[model samples]
Target: MTDAITLRESTPADIAFLQTLYPAAFPDEDLLPLVRSLLELPDVLSLLALARGVPAGHAVFTPGTVGGHAAPVALLGPVAVLPRHQCQGIGSTLIRGGRTRLEAAGTARLLVLGDPAYYGRHGFAATSDIRPPYDLPREWAPAWQSLSLGGDDAPMNGTLRVPGPWCNPALWA
Candidate 1:
Protein backbone atom coordinates (compact mmCIF):
# COMPACT_ATOMS: atom_id res chain seq x y z
CA MET A 1 0.00 0.00 0.00
CA THR A 2 1.08 3.58 -0.61
CA ASP A 3 2.09 5.76 2.27
CA ALA A 4 -0.65 8.01 3.65
CA ILE A 5 -0.79 11.35 1.86
CA THR A 6 -1.48 14.55 3.75
CA LEU A 7 -2.89 17.83 2.52
CA ARG A 8 -1.87 21.09 4.14
CA GLU A 9 -2.58 24.78 3.76
CA SER A 10 0.23 26.28 1.72
CA THR A 11 2.42 28.70 3.59
CA PRO A 12 4.78 31.41 2.40
CA ALA A 13 7.62 28.93 2.76
CA ASP A 14 6.02 26.73 0.09
CA ILE A 15 6.08 29.56 -2.44
CA ALA A 16 9.63 28.90 -3.58
CA PHE A 17 8.96 25.23 -4.19
CA LEU A 18 5.77 26.00 -6.10
CA GLN A 19 7.69 28.52 -8.20
CA THR A 20 9.80 25.58 -9.35
CA LEU A 21 7.05 22.96 -9.42
CA TYR A 22 4.61 24.71 -11.75
CA PRO A 23 7.11 25.21 -14.55
CA ALA A 24 8.46 21.70 -14.30
CA ALA A 25 5.03 20.14 -14.26
CA PHE A 26 3.81 22.23 -17.18
CA PRO A 27 6.92 22.71 -19.24
CA ASP A 28 5.16 23.81 -22.40
CA GLU A 29 2.52 26.06 -20.83
CA ASP A 30 4.67 28.74 -19.12
CA LEU A 31 2.15 28.77 -16.28
CA LEU A 32 4.64 29.30 -13.47
CA PRO A 33 4.18 33.06 -13.25
CA LEU A 34 0.43 32.78 -13.36
CA VAL A 35 0.49 30.14 -10.65
CA ARG A 36 2.69 32.40 -8.56
CA SER A 37 0.25 35.28 -8.90
CA LEU A 38 -2.67 33.08 -7.97
CA LEU A 39 -0.85 31.91 -4.85
CA GLU A 40 -0.59 35.46 -3.64
CA LEU A 41 -4.22 36.35 -4.11
CA PRO A 42 -5.79 36.81 -0.70
CA ASP A 43 -9.11 35.27 -1.72
CA VAL A 44 -7.52 32.16 -3.07
CA LEU A 45 -7.17 28.80 -1.36
CA SER A 46 -3.78 27.17 -1.84
CA LEU A 47 -3.08 23.59 -0.88
CA LEU A 48 -0.14 21.22 -1.04
CA ALA A 49 -0.14 17.46 -1.04
CA LEU A 50 2.62 15.64 0.81
CA ALA A 51 3.41 11.98 0.46
CA ARG A 52 5.79 10.36 2.94
CA GLY A 53 6.60 13.85 4.13
CA VAL A 54 7.47 15.02 0.63
CA PRO A 55 5.71 17.69 -1.37
CA ALA A 56 3.96 15.67 -4.06
CA GLY A 57 1.33 17.98 -5.56
CA HIS A 58 -0.39 21.38 -5.42
CA ALA A 59 -3.75 22.94 -6.29
CA VAL A 60 -5.07 26.52 -6.50
CA PHE A 61 -8.69 27.50 -6.06
CA THR A 62 -9.83 31.08 -6.34
CA PRO A 63 -13.17 32.79 -5.66
CA GLY A 64 -15.04 34.07 -8.67
CA THR A 65 -18.55 35.33 -9.33
CA VAL A 66 -21.31 34.27 -11.70
CA GLY A 67 -21.84 37.96 -12.65
CA GLY A 68 -25.57 38.29 -11.96
CA HIS A 69 -26.18 35.23 -9.84
CA ALA A 70 -25.77 35.24 -6.08
CA ALA A 71 -24.51 31.69 -6.44
CA PRO A 72 -21.14 31.03 -4.86
CA VAL A 73 -18.47 29.53 -7.09
CA ALA A 74 -14.74 28.95 -7.26
CA LEU A 75 -12.22 28.40 -10.03
CA LEU A 76 -9.81 25.45 -10.02
CA GLY A 77 -6.69 25.41 -11.99
CA PRO A 78 -2.96 24.98 -12.31
CA VAL A 79 -3.10 21.80 -10.24
CA ALA A 80 0.26 20.12 -10.52
CA VAL A 81 1.89 16.88 -9.47
CA LEU A 82 5.62 16.45 -9.24
CA PRO A 83 6.93 14.67 -12.29
CA ARG A 84 8.21 11.70 -10.33
CA HIS A 85 4.91 11.42 -8.45
CA GLN A 86 2.57 11.63 -11.42
CA CYS A 87 0.18 8.78 -12.24
CA GLN A 88 0.32 7.68 -8.62
CA GLY A 89 -3.05 9.22 -7.66
CA ILE A 90 -1.38 12.23 -6.06
CA GLY A 91 -3.30 14.56 -8.37
CA SER A 92 -6.54 12.81 -7.50
CA THR A 93 -5.80 13.13 -3.82
CA LEU A 94 -5.12 16.83 -4.24
CA ILE A 95 -8.47 17.29 -5.98
CA ARG A 96 -10.33 15.47 -3.23
CA GLY A 97 -8.80 17.81 -0.68
CA GLY A 98 -9.85 20.79 -2.73
CA ARG A 99 -13.42 19.54 -2.98
CA THR A 100 -13.68 19.01 0.75
CA ARG A 101 -12.32 22.46 1.52
CA LEU A 102 -14.62 24.08 -1.01
CA GLU A 103 -17.58 22.23 0.36
CA ALA A 104 -16.70 23.24 3.90
CA ALA A 105 -16.53 26.83 2.70
CA GLY A 106 -20.04 26.32 1.30
CA THR A 107 -18.99 26.87 -2.27
CA ALA A 108 -21.89 25.67 -4.37
CA ARG A 109 -19.98 24.93 -7.54
CA LEU A 110 -16.53 24.59 -9.13
CA LEU A 111 -15.36 25.53 -12.59
CA VAL A 112 -12.45 24.32 -14.67
CA LEU A 113 -11.12 24.30 -18.18
CA GLY A 114 -9.54 21.05 -19.31
CA ASP A 115 -10.15 17.77 -21.04
CA PRO A 116 -13.77 17.06 -20.13
CA ALA A 117 -13.05 13.39 -19.78
CA TYR A 118 -10.53 13.96 -17.01
CA TYR A 119 -12.49 16.56 -15.01
CA GLY A 120 -15.66 14.61 -15.64
CA ARG A 121 -14.34 11.81 -13.50
CA HIS A 122 -14.36 14.29 -10.62
CA GLY A 123 -18.08 15.08 -11.20
CA PHE A 124 -17.51 18.17 -13.35
CA ALA A 125 -19.36 18.54 -16.61
CA ALA A 126 -19.89 21.08 -19.35
CA THR A 127 -22.15 23.93 -18.25
CA SER A 128 -23.97 26.09 -20.78
CA ASP A 129 -25.67 28.62 -18.52
CA ILE A 130 -22.53 29.87 -16.86
CA ARG A 131 -19.60 30.86 -19.08
CA PRO A 132 -16.21 32.32 -18.58
CA PRO A 133 -15.99 36.08 -19.08
CA TYR A 134 -13.78 35.70 -22.12
CA ASP A 135 -14.80 34.11 -25.33
CA LEU A 136 -13.53 30.57 -25.64
CA PRO A 137 -12.85 29.31 -29.11
CA ARG A 138 -15.81 27.55 -30.70
CA GLU A 139 -14.23 24.11 -30.71
CA TRP A 140 -12.95 24.34 -27.15
CA ALA A 141 -16.39 25.09 -25.71
CA PRO A 142 -16.59 21.65 -24.18
CA ALA A 143 -13.48 22.32 -22.14
CA TRP A 144 -15.29 24.99 -20.13
CA GLN A 145 -17.10 22.98 -17.51
CA SER A 146 -18.58 23.18 -14.03
CA LEU A 147 -19.62 20.87 -11.20
CA SER A 148 -22.49 21.43 -8.80
CA LEU A 149 -21.52 20.39 -5.33
CA GLY A 150 -24.73 20.89 -3.29
CA GLY A 151 -27.06 22.97 -5.37
CA ASP A 152 -30.02 21.95 -7.49
CA ASP A 153 -31.29 25.42 -8.17
CA ALA A 154 -31.97 26.91 -11.55
CA PRO A 155 -29.02 27.89 -13.70
CA MET A 156 -27.80 31.45 -14.11
CA ASN A 157 -26.44 33.09 -17.23
CA GLY A 158 -23.55 35.40 -16.56
CA THR A 159 -19.86 36.11 -16.96
CA LEU A 160 -17.20 35.03 -14.49
CA ARG A 161 -15.25 37.69 -12.61
CA VAL A 162 -11.84 36.21 -12.05
CA PRO A 163 -8.68 37.60 -10.50
CA GLY A 164 -5.84 39.26 -12.37
CA PRO A 165 -3.86 36.09 -13.00
CA TRP A 166 -6.83 34.53 -14.75
CA CYS A 167 -7.46 37.69 -16.79
CA ASN A 168 -4.75 36.81 -19.28
CA PRO A 169 -6.30 35.71 -22.55
CA ALA A 170 -3.88 32.83 -22.92
CA LEU A 171 -5.74 30.91 -20.22
CA TRP A 172 -8.98 30.69 -22.17
CA ALA A 173 -7.29 29.77 -25.42
Candidate 2:
Protein backbone atom coordinates (compact mmCIF):
# COMPACT_ATOMS: atom_id res chain seq x y z
CA MET A 1 0.00 0.00 0.00
CA THR A 2 2.97 2.30 0.25
CA ASP A 3 3.23 2.58 -3.53
CA ALA A 4 1.55 5.55 -5.14
CA ILE A 5 -1.85 4.75 -6.59
CA THR A 6 -2.02 4.48 -10.36
CA LEU A 7 -5.00 4.83 -12.73
CA ARG A 8 -5.65 3.02 -15.96
CA GLU A 9 -8.44 2.07 -18.33
CA SER A 10 -9.86 -1.33 -17.41
CA THR A 11 -9.27 -4.30 -19.66
CA PRO A 12 -10.85 -7.72 -20.05
CA ALA A 13 -8.11 -9.18 -17.91
CA ASP A 14 -9.40 -7.02 -15.05
CA ILE A 15 -12.87 -8.62 -14.99
CA ALA A 16 -11.86 -11.29 -12.50
CA PHE A 17 -10.65 -8.65 -10.10
CA LEU A 18 -13.85 -6.67 -10.55
CA GLN A 19 -16.02 -9.71 -9.78
CA THR A 20 -14.25 -10.16 -6.47
CA LEU A 21 -14.14 -6.45 -5.67
CA TYR A 22 -17.81 -5.61 -6.34
CA PRO A 23 -19.32 -8.02 -3.87
CA ALA A 24 -16.83 -7.03 -1.21
CA ALA A 25 -17.65 -3.38 -1.74
CA PHE A 26 -21.40 -3.96 -1.92
CA PRO A 27 -22.24 -7.11 -0.02
CA ASP A 28 -25.98 -6.67 -0.37
CA GLU A 29 -25.89 -5.93 -4.09
CA ASP A 30 -25.06 -8.01 -7.13
CA LEU A 31 -23.49 -5.63 -9.63
CA LEU A 32 -21.52 -8.20 -11.61
CA PRO A 33 -24.05 -8.58 -14.42
CA LEU A 34 -24.20 -4.86 -15.06
CA VAL A 35 -20.45 -4.50 -14.87
CA ARG A 36 -19.96 -7.32 -17.33
CA SER A 37 -22.45 -5.86 -19.74
CA LEU A 38 -21.00 -2.39 -19.57
CA LEU A 39 -17.56 -3.75 -20.37
CA GLU A 40 -18.81 -5.21 -23.62
CA LEU A 41 -20.49 -2.04 -24.77
CA PRO A 42 -19.07 -0.06 -27.67
CA ASP A 43 -18.57 3.26 -25.89
CA VAL A 44 -18.45 2.66 -22.18
CA LEU A 45 -15.43 3.78 -20.19
CA SER A 46 -14.34 1.57 -17.32
CA LEU A 47 -11.49 2.69 -15.10
CA LEU A 48 -9.32 0.81 -12.67
CA ALA A 49 -7.19 2.05 -9.81
CA LEU A 50 -4.23 0.06 -8.61
CA ALA A 51 -2.13 0.29 -5.48
CA ARG A 52 1.17 -1.48 -5.54
CA GLY A 53 0.11 -3.16 -8.78
CA VAL A 54 -3.04 -4.71 -7.26
CA PRO A 55 -6.54 -3.62 -8.12
CA ALA A 56 -7.81 -1.14 -5.52
CA GLY A 57 -11.02 0.26 -7.03
CA HIS A 58 -13.10 0.41 -10.23
CA ALA A 59 -15.56 2.82 -11.80
CA VAL A 60 -17.81 2.54 -14.84
CA PHE A 61 -19.14 5.27 -17.07
CA THR A 62 -21.74 4.31 -19.63
CA PRO A 63 -22.58 6.65 -22.48
CA GLY A 64 -26.15 7.87 -22.73
CA THR A 65 -28.07 10.76 -24.24
CA VAL A 66 -30.04 13.57 -22.74
CA GLY A 67 -32.53 14.39 -25.47
CA GLY A 68 -31.70 18.06 -25.74
CA HIS A 69 -27.97 17.90 -25.26
CA ALA A 70 -25.99 17.92 -28.47
CA ALA A 71 -22.85 16.87 -26.67
CA PRO A 72 -22.14 13.51 -25.05
CA VAL A 73 -23.65 12.33 -21.78
CA ALA A 74 -22.62 9.50 -19.47
CA LEU A 75 -23.66 7.74 -16.31
CA LEU A 76 -21.31 6.83 -13.48
CA GLY A 77 -22.36 3.94 -11.38
CA PRO A 78 -21.46 1.07 -9.10
CA VAL A 79 -18.12 2.59 -8.20
CA ALA A 80 -16.55 0.03 -5.90
CA VAL A 81 -13.56 -0.14 -3.62
CA LEU A 82 -12.58 -3.04 -1.41
CA PRO A 83 -13.50 -2.64 2.25
CA ARG A 84 -9.83 -2.45 3.14
CA HIS A 85 -9.34 0.29 0.55
CA GLN A 86 -12.18 2.47 1.79
CA CYS A 87 -11.34 6.05 2.84
CA GLN A 88 -7.93 5.90 1.20
CA GLY A 89 -9.19 8.20 -1.60
CA ILE A 90 -9.06 5.32 -4.05
CA GLY A 91 -12.75 5.73 -4.85
CA SER A 92 -12.33 9.45 -5.29
CA THR A 93 -9.29 8.88 -7.42
CA LEU A 94 -11.20 6.50 -9.67
CA ILE A 95 -14.06 8.98 -9.97
CA ARG A 96 -11.91 11.98 -10.76
CA GLY A 97 -9.84 9.96 -13.17
CA GLY A 98 -12.92 8.78 -15.06
CA ARG A 99 -14.33 12.30 -15.20
CA THR A 100 -11.07 13.67 -16.51
CA ARG A 101 -11.04 11.17 -19.35
CA LEU A 102 -14.69 11.74 -20.17
CA GLU A 103 -14.34 15.52 -20.16
CA ALA A 104 -11.41 15.34 -22.50
CA ALA A 105 -13.51 13.22 -24.85
CA GLY A 106 -16.16 15.97 -25.06
CA THR A 107 -18.65 14.43 -22.67
CA ALA A 108 -21.04 17.15 -21.61
CA ARG A 109 -22.69 15.84 -18.48
CA LEU A 110 -22.02 13.01 -16.04
CA LEU A 111 -24.90 11.49 -14.10
CA VAL A 112 -24.85 9.31 -11.01
CA LEU A 113 -27.31 7.71 -8.63
CA GLY A 114 -25.43 7.62 -5.37
CA ASP A 115 -25.01 9.24 -2.00
CA PRO A 116 -25.52 12.99 -2.26
CA ALA A 117 -22.92 13.79 0.38
CA TYR A 118 -20.20 11.65 -1.14
CA TYR A 119 -20.95 12.62 -4.75
CA GLY A 120 -21.56 16.24 -3.74
CA ARG A 121 -18.01 16.42 -2.52
CA HIS A 122 -16.97 15.48 -6.06
CA GLY A 123 -19.09 18.28 -7.64
CA PHE A 124 -22.29 16.33 -8.37
CA ALA A 125 -25.41 18.29 -7.56
CA ALA A 126 -29.09 17.42 -7.64
CA THR A 127 -30.25 18.43 -11.10
CA SER A 128 -33.82 19.19 -12.06
CA ASP A 129 -32.90 19.85 -15.68
CA ILE A 130 -32.57 16.20 -16.53
CA ARG A 131 -34.51 13.24 -15.19
CA PRO A 132 -33.65 9.65 -14.41
CA PRO A 133 -34.76 6.89 -16.77
CA TYR A 134 -37.16 5.54 -14.19
CA ASP A 135 -39.09 7.36 -11.57
CA LEU A 136 -37.09 7.60 -8.36
CA PRO A 137 -38.50 7.25 -4.87
CA ARG A 138 -39.44 10.52 -3.22
CA GLU A 139 -36.81 10.20 -0.53
CA TRP A 140 -34.20 8.95 -3.00
CA ALA A 141 -34.53 12.04 -5.18
CA PRO A 142 -31.34 13.59 -3.93
CA ALA A 143 -29.42 10.44 -4.78
CA TRP A 144 -29.88 11.16 -8.50
CA GLN A 145 -27.29 13.76 -9.34
CA SER A 146 -25.19 15.21 -12.15
CA LEU A 147 -21.94 17.05 -12.84
CA SER A 148 -21.16 19.28 -15.81
CA LEU A 149 -18.00 18.22 -17.61
CA GLY A 150 -17.22 21.64 -19.11
CA GLY A 151 -19.35 20.85 -22.11
CA ASP A 152 -21.90 23.63 -22.36
CA ASP A 153 -23.95 25.97 -20.22
CA ALA A 154 -27.16 25.52 -22.18
CA PRO A 155 -29.63 23.62 -19.99
CA MET A 156 -30.64 20.15 -21.07
CA ASN A 157 -34.07 18.65 -20.37
CA GLY A 158 -34.91 15.03 -20.98
CA THR A 159 -35.01 11.56 -19.49
CA LEU A 160 -31.67 9.80 -19.65
CA ARG A 161 -31.67 7.09 -22.30
CA VAL A 162 -29.40 4.38 -20.95
CA PRO A 163 -28.23 1.08 -22.36
CA GLY A 164 -30.25 -2.13 -22.18
CA PRO A 165 -28.50 -3.38 -19.04
CA TRP A 166 -29.47 -0.31 -17.03
CA CYS A 167 -33.14 -0.44 -18.08
CA ASN A 168 -33.95 -2.59 -15.06
CA PRO A 169 -36.45 -0.94 -12.77
CA ALA A 170 -35.01 -2.64 -9.70
CA LEU A 171 -31.68 -0.92 -10.18
CA TRP A 172 -33.38 2.46 -10.40
CA ALA A 173 -34.74 2.08 -6.89
Candidate 3:
Protein backbone atom coordinates (compact mmCIF):
# COMPACT_ATOMS: atom_id res chain seq x y z
CA MET A 1 0.00 0.00 0.00
CA THR A 2 0.06 3.31 -1.34
CA ASP A 3 -2.16 5.54 0.83
CA ALA A 4 -3.55 7.74 -1.91
CA ILE A 5 -4.82 4.98 -4.20
CA THR A 6 -8.06 3.27 -3.16
CA LEU A 7 -8.64 -0.27 -4.46
CA ARG A 8 -12.08 -1.78 -4.82
CA GLU A 9 -14.12 -4.25 -6.82
CA SER A 10 -15.42 -2.57 -9.91
CA THR A 11 -19.16 -2.02 -10.20
CA PRO A 12 -21.14 -2.21 -13.43
CA ALA A 13 -21.24 1.55 -13.56
CA ASP A 14 -17.46 1.72 -13.66
CA ILE A 15 -17.27 -0.09 -17.00
CA ALA A 16 -17.68 3.15 -18.91
CA PHE A 17 -14.88 4.75 -16.99
CA LEU A 18 -12.65 1.76 -17.71
CA GLN A 19 -13.54 1.93 -21.39
CA THR A 20 -12.14 5.43 -21.51
CA LEU A 21 -9.18 4.63 -19.31
CA TYR A 22 -7.95 1.74 -21.46
CA PRO A 23 -7.67 3.78 -24.63
CA ALA A 24 -5.91 6.58 -22.80
CA ALA A 25 -3.39 4.17 -21.32
CA PHE A 26 -2.82 2.09 -24.47
CA PRO A 27 -3.35 4.44 -27.38
CA ASP A 28 -2.13 2.01 -30.04
CA GLU A 29 -3.88 -1.17 -28.96
CA ASP A 30 -7.65 -1.44 -28.73
CA LEU A 31 -8.31 -3.28 -25.49
CA LEU A 32 -11.86 -2.07 -24.94
CA PRO A 33 -13.53 -5.10 -26.54
CA LEU A 34 -11.46 -7.55 -24.54
CA VAL A 35 -12.20 -5.65 -21.35
CA ARG A 36 -15.91 -5.76 -22.06
CA SER A 37 -15.79 -9.48 -22.80
CA LEU A 38 -13.64 -10.41 -19.81
CA LEU A 39 -16.12 -8.66 -17.53
CA GLU A 40 -18.72 -11.30 -18.35
CA LEU A 41 -16.59 -14.33 -17.54
CA PRO A 42 -17.55 -16.20 -14.38
CA ASP A 43 -15.27 -15.75 -11.37
CA VAL A 44 -13.30 -13.00 -13.04
CA LEU A 45 -11.84 -10.49 -10.62
CA SER A 46 -11.91 -6.95 -11.94
CA LEU A 47 -10.32 -4.43 -9.63
CA LEU A 48 -10.28 -0.70 -9.92
CA ALA A 49 -7.72 1.68 -8.49
CA LEU A 50 -9.44 4.95 -7.81
CA ALA A 51 -7.57 8.12 -7.08
CA ARG A 52 -9.89 10.69 -5.60
CA GLY A 53 -13.03 8.81 -6.67
CA VAL A 54 -12.10 8.49 -10.36
CA PRO A 55 -10.72 5.39 -12.01
CA ALA A 56 -6.95 5.62 -12.29
CA GLY A 57 -6.00 1.98 -12.94
CA HIS A 58 -7.58 -1.39 -13.67
CA ALA A 59 -6.63 -5.10 -13.54
CA VAL A 60 -8.41 -8.37 -14.26
CA PHE A 61 -7.92 -11.98 -13.15
CA THR A 62 -9.96 -14.73 -14.69
CA PRO A 63 -10.35 -18.48 -14.37
CA GLY A 64 -7.78 -20.64 -16.18
CA THR A 65 -6.88 -24.31 -16.08
CA VAL A 66 -3.71 -26.24 -16.56
CA GLY A 67 -4.09 -29.30 -18.78
CA GLY A 68 -3.71 -31.93 -16.09
CA HIS A 69 -4.56 -30.25 -12.80
CA ALA A 70 -7.72 -29.37 -10.97
CA ALA A 71 -6.03 -26.90 -8.67
CA PRO A 72 -7.31 -23.37 -9.11
CA VAL A 73 -5.38 -20.92 -11.26
CA ALA A 74 -5.92 -17.59 -13.00
CA LEU A 75 -4.68 -15.49 -15.90
CA LEU A 76 -3.91 -11.82 -15.25
CA GLY A 77 -3.51 -9.25 -17.92
CA PRO A 78 -4.50 -6.07 -19.74
CA VAL A 79 -3.69 -4.24 -16.54
CA ALA A 80 -4.00 -0.58 -17.39
CA VAL A 81 -3.37 2.75 -15.73
CA LEU A 82 -4.28 6.06 -17.24
CA PRO A 83 -1.34 7.78 -18.94
CA ARG A 84 -1.55 10.64 -16.44
CA HIS A 85 -1.41 8.13 -13.60
CA GLN A 86 1.29 5.81 -14.91
CA CYS A 87 4.24 5.10 -12.60
CA GLN A 88 2.35 6.63 -9.66
CA GLY A 89 2.06 3.23 -7.91
CA ILE A 90 -1.61 2.83 -8.82
CA GLY A 91 -0.86 -0.20 -11.03
CA SER A 92 1.22 -1.83 -8.35
CA THR A 93 -1.47 -1.24 -5.77
CA LEU A 94 -4.14 -2.79 -7.94
CA ILE A 95 -1.94 -5.84 -8.62
CA ARG A 96 -1.05 -6.35 -4.98
CA GLY A 97 -4.66 -5.95 -3.92
CA GLY A 98 -5.88 -8.36 -6.59
CA ARG A 99 -3.23 -10.94 -5.73
CA THR A 100 -4.22 -10.84 -2.07
CA ARG A 101 -7.90 -11.30 -2.84
CA LEU A 102 -7.25 -14.08 -5.32
CA GLU A 103 -5.01 -15.95 -2.92
CA ALA A 104 -7.62 -15.71 -0.21
CA ALA A 105 -10.20 -17.01 -2.67
CA GLY A 106 -7.98 -20.07 -3.30
CA THR A 107 -6.21 -19.25 -6.54
CA ALA A 108 -3.18 -21.50 -6.74
CA ARG A 109 -1.13 -19.70 -9.36
CA LEU A 110 -1.31 -16.89 -11.86
CA LEU A 111 0.01 -16.62 -15.41
CA VAL A 112 0.64 -13.52 -17.43
CA LEU A 113 1.91 -12.40 -20.82
CA GLY A 114 3.50 -9.12 -19.88
CA ASP A 115 6.75 -7.34 -19.37
CA PRO A 116 8.98 -9.59 -17.28
CA ALA A 117 10.54 -6.65 -15.50
CA TYR A 118 7.32 -5.05 -14.28
CA TYR A 119 5.54 -8.28 -13.36
CA GLY A 120 8.72 -9.66 -11.80
CA ARG A 121 8.57 -6.88 -9.25
CA HIS A 122 5.16 -8.25 -8.25
CA GLY A 123 6.52 -11.83 -7.83
CA PHE A 124 6.03 -13.09 -11.35
CA ALA A 125 8.87 -14.93 -13.08
CA ALA A 126 9.33 -16.64 -16.41
CA THR A 127 8.24 -20.26 -16.53
CA SER A 128 9.74 -22.95 -18.66
CA ASP A 129 8.33 -26.45 -19.34
CA ILE A 130 4.82 -25.01 -19.22
CA ARG A 131 3.15 -23.58 -22.32
CA PRO A 132 -0.03 -21.91 -23.42
CA PRO A 133 -2.51 -24.08 -25.36
CA TYR A 134 -2.08 -21.87 -28.38
CA ASP A 135 1.39 -21.03 -29.56
CA LEU A 136 2.48 -17.82 -27.95
CA PRO A 137 5.01 -16.14 -30.23
CA ARG A 138 8.52 -17.44 -29.76
CA GLU A 139 9.87 -14.05 -28.76
CA TRP A 140 7.33 -13.93 -25.95
CA ALA A 141 8.80 -16.98 -24.24
CA PRO A 142 10.64 -14.71 -21.87
CA ALA A 143 7.51 -12.72 -21.23
CA TRP A 144 5.38 -15.75 -20.31
CA GLN A 145 5.51 -15.80 -16.57
CA SER A 146 3.83 -17.43 -13.59
CA LEU A 147 3.65 -16.90 -9.86
CA SER A 148 2.76 -19.13 -6.96
CA LEU A 149 -0.18 -17.51 -5.23
CA GLY A 150 -0.67 -19.44 -2.01
CA GLY A 151 -0.41 -22.67 -3.97
CA ASP A 152 2.19 -25.32 -4.59
CA ASP A 153 5.61 -24.12 -5.67
CA ALA A 154 6.00 -26.93 -8.14
CA PRO A 155 6.60 -25.87 -11.73
CA MET A 156 3.39 -25.46 -13.73
CA ASN A 157 4.15 -28.09 -16.43
CA GLY A 158 1.22 -28.04 -18.79
CA THR A 159 -0.60 -26.09 -21.47
CA LEU A 160 -2.99 -23.36 -20.29
CA ARG A 161 -6.65 -22.87 -21.16
CA VAL A 162 -8.04 -19.47 -20.47
CA PRO A 163 -11.55 -18.08 -20.84
CA GLY A 164 -13.08 -17.77 -24.32
CA PRO A 165 -12.65 -14.04 -24.71
CA TRP A 166 -8.98 -14.38 -23.90
CA CYS A 167 -8.48 -17.09 -26.50
CA ASN A 168 -8.01 -14.62 -29.33
CA PRO A 169 -5.04 -15.52 -31.54
CA ALA A 170 -4.12 -11.88 -31.85
CA LEU A 171 -3.37 -11.77 -28.15
CA TRP A 172 -1.05 -14.78 -28.28
CA ALA A 173 0.94 -13.16 -31.04
Give the range where candidate 1 is weakest over 10 consecutive residues by summed lDDT: 148-157
Question: What does the lDDT read for residue 49 in candidate 1?
Answer: 89
Under the 3 Å rule for N, CA and C atoms, how many clashes does model 1 have? 0
TM-score of 3: 0.95
Clashing pairs in 2: none
TM-score of each: 0.93, 0.95, 0.95
Ranking by TM-score: 2, 3, 1
The CA lDDT of each predicted structure is 0.84, 0.89, 0.86
Name the runs in model 3 displaced over 4 angstroms: none
Error of 2 at 130 (Å): 0.5
Q: Which stretches of candidate 1 lie over 4 Å from their true place?
A: 1-3, 151-153
In candidate 2, which residue ranges exceed 4 Å CA deviation? 1-3
For residues 60-124, write the lDDT of model 1, one tens digit per residue. 99998887777678999978988988888888888888888888887878899888888988988
Residue 126 shift from truth in candidate 1, angstroms = 0.9
Choose the strongest candidate by lDDT.
2
lDDT of 1: 0.84
